[model samples]
Target: MSIQIGDTIPEVTLKHIHDGVRVIDTPTVFSGKNVVMFAVPGAFTPTCSEHHLPGFVARFDDFRSRGVDVVCIAVNDPFVLQAWGESVGVPPGLQMLADGNADFVRALGLEMDASAYGMGTRARRFALYAEDGVVRHLFVEAPGEFKVSSADNVLAHLD
Candidate 1:
């Protein structure tokens, strides 16, 4: 079953590129913090690159002011994620987490098969509000749709 509101995030290791080095086994990066984690189907896709990420980037200050740390996730390798982040000018405080192997996506039960598009396994577009690693609110989009999980929507929820 897909993860729902009130579900505690599973403990999983996510890869990230930090200071030109590959970091592994990092834990509790978001623990004990108010977090807004949004997942996209893939990195560098049109919707994600153009709309989803930029929305979060634009609203970073607002989210931080509301006591929320924002992060974006995708089912791509760390290098690709890092390149994408740099290409789009990701802000310093916003993290782009890589679920490259889809372990984290599977754990959340939010994995989607997009092999028809040659995308292989990917994450369903969604946004979640978490406190201390437990979900407090969730907004998952229907396939091919992008409404409820937009930055604006998440912002309204934070209000």
Candidate 2:
């Protein structure tokens, strides 16, 4: 079943790029913390590259002040995520985590097959407020839609 509000995140290792090296199995990175994790279809896609990521980057300070740590996840590799974060001007306090194997996505039951689009498996656009590793709020978007999971919407929920 899809992870809903009140569901705790599973213990799954996700990869990330740090100092030009690919680091793997970093599941406890968010442990014991209040985090806002949002997943996108893929990295460098139009909507995701332009609005979705920049929105979070722009409002990162607000999220931090609200005591919410923000992270962006995609099915791409860590290199792509790192480059994308640089290209999009990702701000401080926001992490670009790479769920390249889709383990975490499957754990959350948010995995989607984009094989028809030549993308293979990827994550749907959604945002979750996790307090100390347990979900407090979830905003999942309809297929091909980008409404509720927007940074503004998540901010409203934080308010």
Q: Pick by lDDT: which candidate is best?
A: 1
Q: In order, what lDDT does every prediction score?
A: 0.89, 0.88
Off by over 4 Å in 1: 24-27
| Deviation of model 1 at 35, angstroms | 0.3
Q: Cα lDDT of model 1 overall?
A: 0.89
- Over the stretch 1-159, how does candidate 1's per-residue lDDT look in tens digits? 988888888888888888774654424666789999999999899999999999999889999999899988999988998899998889998988898889998999999999999999999999999988889889999999999999999999988
lDDT of model 1 at residue 117?
100
Residue-level error in angstroms, candidate 1, position 49: 0.9
